[model samples]
Target: MATQAVTNPVPVADLRRRPGRSASLRRIARKKPVGAIAAVICLLLILIAISADLLAPQGANQIDPLKNPRLLSPSLSHPFGTDNLFRDVFTRIVIGSRISLGVGFTAVFIGTVIGASLGIVSGYFRGKTDLVVSRAMEVVLGFPPLVLAIFILAIFNTSKGYSFRSFLLLSFAIGVIIAPTTARIVRGSALSIRNLQYVEAAESIGNTSFGIMRRHVLPNVVAPIIVIASIQIGNAILAEAALSFLGLGISDAYHPSWGTMLQEGRPVWLEAWWMSVIPGTAIAFAVLSFNLFGDALRDVLDPRLRQSS
Candidate 1:
């Protein structure tokens, strides 16, 4: 008599989800305290960017050297004080959030698309394809990020500066800089999935490579990609700031980027500290928020990290 073998069954509601991989916001907040704070800071930044026009008391570039005292220290009238041009420093900082965060988000999106495509294809195919891609990524990593960014920007001749087109050009340059790092991380994760039993089973069943990658490999790599993409956004923000500081990125006249603010404050920093300090602080907080959120996300989502947690 062939006896039917029985085994313990998971609850239907639980399904295939692992114990620590809760997708609930409450769970995230309870499990990771720092992540909650980062999430709040990031949310505030986005809200400020979105509502810059309404929130800012004055226009970002509304200058009145005679009406408003230049380089006035932080006061009731000007919370962040005034720049040399007597423009409201608070207004510029508020407006700059839009440009800074815009560049960061856009650059990460571009990097993710390019890096994930290369990594999944290379990791799944292996052999010559893997070798070629690995070498190319290594070559890209060899160049200094700022140098590579400058080289790419030169191609566009963005000396004209601060238009919507220039904004995209800057984002694309930073995206290219971050793509190799993203590819390296993604490829490692994909390689692990490629050797899994289910993937081999799919291959044995004569599934197409693209089908296998999409159905099996891509889904598995998504967690790592999310973590990587968030961290890349922080890097992109810093990169854009650096370029703007060098007068190579967004124009201060059109868009008052934190980096441009720093450049403006450099000469007057000795006497007017508010100009540099305020914008520099903004950049630090923005980067820290994203990076901390990325770390927290990785701890929650990555199985290895979750085990340690």
Candidate 2:
């Protein structure tokens, strides 16, 4: 008796077509208005920060003390108006963006680097190292970021001379404070990615743990970490400003920081509203943009959200 001939099923390209089409549709659906506005705002702020030197009308800290009278409203000469000391508010705001952006980006960079490293190690190892790092992160998370910043600034001011030390201290403190969140995010992402089939395949092929993590796991986890860090940059900027406004941040009173401006303007708010108003708006918009852009990024990057759409 002749055996019945067996045949494999034909591969259909159409099977791949729907998913691709659906994915495209989903991408379109995930576009949110808030996210778009946020991204634009964030981009605008970044541009402003980058071009601050060129954009600013004069030296950030320069005080005419005579040319423009105090409390002058917005005008062709001074768009944001002059402060109590006849300092150009527009110039100060332009220059202040540099400081805010600098602190925010620096802090986020430090936090993300430190957090991602610790998180990757902790998640991959899942032993004493993880326990220690997790516990330490928890402890750090317990304190209010502002309070911790104040303590750190106080210590630094007392011990080290204040010029760059204050700026460094503020960035370091903010980085440390924000690190726990990044660590947690990275750890979660690593944990999920660690058990994927590719990871198992790499292990089966005799790839070292470190090699597998570095090559395969880290790349996948880094995307979310990057997005988080981007969002966190704005928060860090705001935090630094708050600390400065509270007199616990950058010690240079002469520097043209939005926070410093706010602090200086507090007493003269009624007299010189422009001093605080312009800087305050700048801070608000910068923070808002980062947050909104981050949200948009999340929508754009999230596979689940994309799938739903």
Candidate 3:
């Protein structure tokens, strides 16, 4: 009688030692160095955003009474220095990350999910629906995104001051600004998906149009969606910051936004450079990291780009 062979269990440690995240990361680094760097930066940003309370040295709004604390400048004691209120700039920035990332991600999610669904329907049925959707997208595209956002925020009665509800409203406004572009991109990608054999098979199998779009069309077009989403997260962040700067957004004293920081600093900037420079640098870093990661993701994800490379 032949005995069944007993298999030896591999340790989880051994599995890790063999090839996995590290190997994939190394391959990514080798194939796309800039992308890898950008990925690291984005990761760091996320980590900081997540651990803000733990990492911050002081309360976001705690006004330190330390001698001449106002705009003390960056040093060992205060990395980002103090603001005019003697509040910790570093702490405020850290806390502010919660707001910025929350808005950016939420807005992008709203925009992408809504836009992708609309786009799939528009592209899958290319008659009157397509014509109407495409024209509507064009009309939305015709407006300046920032201006549209400002208008929407105003219409939503954001004058009630920046509360949790108001922040959500601001996010919705920004999401609307983002939706048209995402719709256009997803629409273009969905168009090609219609000709795929699987799509035909799905239809032949009596799969509902929605099912076909959800299962086949959506998955096929995900690469572009991912790249667009990454890029748009950064845009959403910038929009939040810009609106905040314009006094049309976040202004709660307890909350510290880079845009609001900039607004506060604008008057006293000459007297205290860190007030402007530090928050400005933070904004730049976030936007640049996102843009770089998005560009790198596009290069890596796009089938045409992958083939060319």
TM-score of each: 0.90, 0.85, 0.90
Name the TM-score of candidate 2: 0.85
The per-model lDDT (C-alpha) reads: 0.89, 0.80, 0.86
Clashing pairs in 1: none
Candidate 3 per-residue C-alpha lDDT over 237-293 given as tens digits, one digit per residue, 9 for 90 to 100: 999999989988765787778888888899897899988888888888898889899
* Candidate 3 similarity to native, TM-score: 0.90
Give the per-residue Cα lDDT of candidate 1 at 283.
96
- Per residue, candidate 2 scores C-alpha lDDT tens digits across 1-309 of 998765865468755656577776565446676776666677787898898888877776676767776779999987899877777888888777777888899899988989998899888887798899999999888998888877777776654323666667778888988999999989999888888899899999999989998999899987788789878988998998998788665535345678888888888888777778878888898887888778677767878875786
Report the Cα lDDT for residue 281, model 3.
Answer: 89
- Candidate 1 total steric clashes: 0
Residue pairs of candidate 2 with colliding backbone atoms: none
Stretches of candidate 2 above 4 Å error?
1-30, 157-165, 251-254
Per-residue error for 245 in candidate 3, Å, reads: 0.2
**Model 1, range 146-259, lDDT digits (tens) per residue?**
999999998985357577888888989999989988898889988989999999999999999999999999998898899999888889999999998988877667478998
